[model samples]
Target: MNAVGVDVGGTKIAAGVVTPEGKILDEVRYPTPHSPGTLVETIARAITEVGDAPEVGGVCLAVPGLVLAQENKVVYSPNLRAVEGIPLKDELEPKIGMPLTVENDGNAAAWGEFRFGVGSEADHLVFVTLGTGIGGGVITHGILMRGAQGSGGELGHVTIQATGPRCACGNHGCLEALASGTAIGRRARELAVEHPDSALGRLAARRQILGEDVTELAREGDEVALSVLDEAGRWLGVGLAGFINIFNPEVVAVGGGVMEAEELVLEAARKEVILRARPPSRDLADVKVATLGPKSGVLGAAALARDASSREYLLGG
Candidate 1:
């Protein structure tokens, strides 16, 4: 049997029919709607489109928000404002005519990595997705640690610098503010303005200098761009070092669109982790790039639905 996975992101919503072993059988994507009700309908549409298989057992949604899992509600989502305080599962299940599971997007990605990606063999792992903002998921003894209210894995909001720049979360010096894609873009713009004659500056003058632009320019040996990435990488390393000392996970997988630069970021993070992470724990876990790529969120959601179905079946529901 297959399960349906829906990844509701800030800019887009994606869905896929996933085999039990994590293979995606089919997938579809749509632009995210701005209205709460419309977004829910869009998600349902995506689910229906991808989960057309006769054997699909259940559906799961990976939401980018502070999901109140027990209530199937989205308490808050800075990126997707429409979902705020919405009873998503309640609204969608009847429309879709299936059992539903709701989970935090970071947790979903982590679950995907735990079950089928880079951390498949690890008993303890941490997964961080660094994009427009940072998202986090943690697994210990093969079980997700959602805390009492399902808000446990918010690693991006963790403070890396006490007096650094302000984060979108309204906090000062969060890991997200320092190392996320937004942060990279912001820094690149700043550097470009400071050095108007440089490559980054010339590029910024032509159009908006995005995080991808910074990375590309760095790869082409632009000094200003390299400096921005290096700064972001160091902050990422600091955050990873903190996670290493605290959780002591066996593996840590980092992913997200910003990671397109790959070794440009991970190499710096590893170097800093080696410098700051506590002794044996530092040596215990190997931080690696997430191999699942963009499919992690949907696959994880599918895994969530699959697990829910198995539990219901075992209980004779």
Candidate 2:
């Protein structure tokens, strides 16, 4: 069986036709639209472009922000303003002529990784995507834990500092406020202005200093850039340490574009987790980079769709 998975991001929408075994048969990407209405149209167009495969049993979307899965509504998305409060599944299911499932992008990525990537063999794990923001999902006893409100694993919003920078969630010192791609970029830009002779400053002068730019500069042995990532990683570790103490999962997978920095981020996070997390919990869980890379979200969404389709087919038979 096959299904369509759409990963909706702030700047791009990636869709893929995937098989039951987690193979992506085909894929396409398009720039995200600014209009809410057009955004829906763009998603439909993405599905169409990917091919209307007869084997496709359903369609699934991995959307950012607080997703009310049962209602098929995106309660809020900081990056994509237009999707907030929209009944995305209701809007797209009919147009695409398929049953649909909606999930939080973070949860979808975690699910993808758990079923097909690094945590495939683990019965308990946590998945964190350190991208534009820190999105996370938790799984325990072979079940995805969505709290009473269906927003249980929002690890990014967990407060790491009582008086740090502001977060998109309107809170201060959340993990995302300190460790996300946006936070790294913001800090790098500030350091650039402060230390005009630094490599980060030089790159800022040439153009905008995005989080990836900082990581690239750090790779070249730039002091300011290196420090920026180090700080971000330390904060990431601090946040994970808390999670370790709380959930004590067997494994934790960290993925997203920013993780390309590898050692610079993981090393610091590991060091901090060791320093902060309680003994056995810290020792029990291993924090590793996600193997699925950037495709986790779409792949996870596809997995969900395929599973649901399989259940329906079995019931009908």
Candidate 3:
């Protein structure tokens, strides 16, 4: 069966019709509006634009927020506050002419990887995206492990250092505060000030140091930039090691913009995983890059939509 998935972000909205095999049939994109009404209208329009599949069973919205999946609502979204507290299913179903569901963008993306990307062969998988903030999901025994309120698998918020940097979520020492793109930038700026003679320091003196800039400087053989990435990666691995012990996933797939640094960061993370993660689990878990990249949200949400439809039909039958 075909389904439609909408990946709604702070900047843009991407909607696509997808088949069971994970091919996108039709797709549309729109700049996301900040107001509640316009956000709803934009999402509805995007869905309608791409939902022409003759047998689209359902639609799922991949939203960046604390989603109440049972209610098909987003309770809170830090980056895209426009989506919060909205009756998404009630509003979207009427406009798009189909049943709709909602999910955390991270969870939806993890499902996409499990279904079609790196975790295709694994029954247990852990997927994390390192962007402005860290977000992640877990699939264990072929099941997406949403907690009691459908807010589980929040890997980014896990605390690594008790007295470390503050997170946007108001926590101290969260993995997001140490290993995300935002964290990388913040750390790079600090390092640039400390080492004002290096290439990173030279650039930071001229303009604000962004995460991509750190990666570029590292590629050009700047020791200071390389150190910043290594620090973040080690922090990430510290968090991942705990997850490895708890979930024992066969694969740990990392994605998002920060991954552009690739091995520059992952190499350090792998070393920490080896040092901290217990034997057998550490040896068994394969830390690698996610293949779906940015499209994971749309594809995963579509797959979840199909899964939801199948369940409903079976129940009705």
Candidate 4:
């Protein structure tokens, strides 16, 4: 049976009806609403629009927040604050007329990669997305490791440097604070002030330096811009090395806007991993770019919905 996956992002919500084989049969996108009532309605609309087929069995929402899996609710989401404290399953299930569940967006993306993307060939995988913030999830022994509170795979919050910049989560020296796209932009702006004649500096003089601008400048061989990415990549590597030691995943898949720089960023991260990560696990992990890109959350959530449907059938039988 097919299932519906809803990716509730900060700016928009995307829902897709996906087959067991991972093909998206139908999809819809809607701008995310900020109000609690409108947010629930928007999500319900997206699901119903995409999941018209009777073959679609269930649904899972991939949301940006600290989700309570058992309760199927979002407890906190800094990026999409309107989703906070909403009992999503309770609100959405009735509207969409299906069994629904909620998952952290990062976990959903990790599952997507494991099931259909770069990590499809690996039983153990680590997934990290470097966007406005750093989000990550882990699949070890073929299962997601959600902690007691359903916040287990929060890789970005780990402190790699005790004295680094502050993160959105208010933590200092967090991997997110150093390696996220937001961090890249912040770093780029800071460096532009030091090298006013550089391309990045010239651009920043006109307007704020975004993460994409940094990548563009680096591609043009701007030294200051390249250095900013190099620093962020090294910090990312520091975080990945710790994950390598703990989970020992076979593949570490990196995704998100920052990764558009590709080798410009990952080359440095790999070098750091080689230096810091220990023997077997370090040597075994293949750090690669995620294949699904922006669609991972939707695909992964659909997979989770399929899993939930199977579990329900077994429980009922």
Q: Best-fitting candidate, measured by lDDT?
A: 3
- TM-score per prediction, in order, is 0.96, 0.92, 0.97, 0.97
- Per-residue C-alpha lDDT of model 2 across residues 1-317, encoded as one tens digit per residue: 78888999999999999887899999999999989999999999998777477688788899888888778888888889998887877888788888888888898888889878998889788999998889989877766777876667899999999999999999999999999999999999999999889998988888998999998999999999999999999999999998889888889899988899988999999999999999898999899999999899989889878765565423421
Per-residue lDDT, model 2, residue 33, is: 97
Clashes of each: 0, 0, 0, 0
Total backbone collisions, model 3: 0
Q: Give me the runs in candidate 4 sitting further than 4 Å from their true place.
A: 311-317
Residue range 1-317, candidate 3, lDDT tens digits: 89998999989999999999999999999999999999999999898888876888799999997888789888879999988999999988888888899999999999999989999999899999999999999998888988999988899999999999999999999999999999999999999999999999899889999999999999999999999999999999999999999999999999999999999999999999999999889999999999999999999999999987676423421
- The order of the candidates by lDDT, greatest first, is 3, 4, 1, 2
RMSD of 4: 2.2
**lDDT of the structure predicted as candidate 3:** 0.93
The number of residue pairs in model 1 that clash at the backbone is: 0
For residues 81-178, write the lDDT of model 1, one tens digit per residue. 99898888789899898889889999999999988899988988999999999998998877787899888899999999999999998999999999
- Candidate 2 segments whose C-alpha is farther than 4 A from its true place: 309-317
In model 3, the Cα lDDT at residue 283 comes to 96
All candidates' lDDT scores?
A: 0.91, 0.88, 0.93, 0.92
Native-to-model Cα distance after best TM-score fit, residue 37 in candidate 4, in Å: 0.3
Between which residue pairs do clashes occur in model 3? none
